[model samples]
Target: MTPVPPSRADRSSPGEVLRAGPLEIHATARQAFVNGARITLGSRAFDLLLMLAEAAGRVVSHDEIQARVWPNRHVSETNLRVQVSTLRRALGEARHVVSTVPDRGYAFTPFGQHAPEPDDAPVPGDHVVHVVDDEADMRDALEGLLMASGWRVRTYGSVGAFQEALTAQTAGCLILDVSLPGENGLELQRRLLALGLSLPIVFLSGRSNIPIAVEAMKAGAIEFLTKPAAGEDILAAVARAMALALSERPQSPA
Candidate 1:
């Protein structure tokens, strides 16, 4: 039998708090705790947990899970499975709380349900990694790779597309292709500087042009790499960019 998707009331609002076994979930704050100790969860994992826990004891179908978690984005089964694995790992010994419901989907079985102790951990900011490449295949590949690594990702086909979607409040690093159809990566970098946007950029070029690479570095690019860069190298560059971006981000007032 097909499971019914949770309605608005059935879904947990960001302001609501949920407790199941040793898990204490703060939907509003986007946080979770086990046995009063806060646990680190990727953004997607946290969202999945809230959805399942809100619909506790009920099966959330694969379609519903993908829609709720990825929203308008189309993701592969592997993405969902990877996120589930990540969430389960974060749950530790209480991983059984999230159970696979045969071929239907998954359910949160409120095992050993109990009240949660008070917790006061500050919430961490959520960041996304943006990838801009003219090649559709490249964009998809990079998105999957980064998402699998637990980083939220957004991809664009060109500088115009990226600029259209960018805003002052946008956070995270950018993986940019050097030779774009319009504006090009270096031009965009210059424009961003003129506009005072401090988004960290990691440039990828099909050709190894020393002059262009040096210019990008002088303009404050976190890393510049020739195309077909190793996955480990890309990941490392992104990690450094994220660290720089987060450090520059203004902290919220207490």
Candidate 2:
């Protein structure tokens, strides 16, 4: 198997092996092997795969993909298509997980009848990310990555605690788990919305149900991620969430 060098995303991860059905991805190492044999991926292909993997199931648009893969220069649509084809070859039969949405973008599954469209609304102030996940490991992992990346962060093991904290400090973004002991992330999101709290929400889940993801998107969640997602993907989502929060932030009196 080929030894894949670490990427920026790997530094924040625990170096554990991530399993998605038959594929094995080493997050810390930035390597993928199938049946113990290494799969070769060009730099662009790897970046694309990592982005999709971290999305947790959200459809990543062509523009977003280009921005990630080619941050500076303009990449032609043909180039994007070529890179996608290459990634599909690497995934082999498992590639079906990456589904194309004509006129929209690419999603991780075929179950979604439509695609998520991000708003450019702006909010202001520090973009603190408030994370709520029952798993201590998950919470720590996110905190380490987000804080190290220069984002302000606060974490809670439950929605109630996060809610309590919100009264004092409004988080610019919220990263939450779909499953919790009581009052899951979706419920908390609804509650927040009712109270006029529209912070960008990003959902993480080990149990991925398409309908539920759709529901979260419908409720205005920035993104819904499935478990074992790459830290890079989480970071990308957080960036998006923060941008939304900044746009949505109320205007201060001039």
Candidates' C-alpha lDDT: 0.75, 0.71
Model 1 poorest 10 in a row by lDDT: 114-123
In angstroms, the error of model 1 at 240 is 0.1
Provide TM-scores for the models: 0.52, 0.54
**Model 2 bad stretches (over 4 Å):** 1-125
Cα error, residue 143 of model 2, in Å, equals: 0.3
Q: lDDT of candidate 2 vs native? A: 0.71
| Tens-digit per-residue lDDT, 80-125, candidate 2 | 6445644765776455455554346766542222224354443334
lDDT of 2 at 225: 68
- lDDT per residue for candidate 1 within 132-199, as digits (tens), equals 99999989988988988878889999999999998988888899999999799999999999989888
TM-score of 2: 0.54
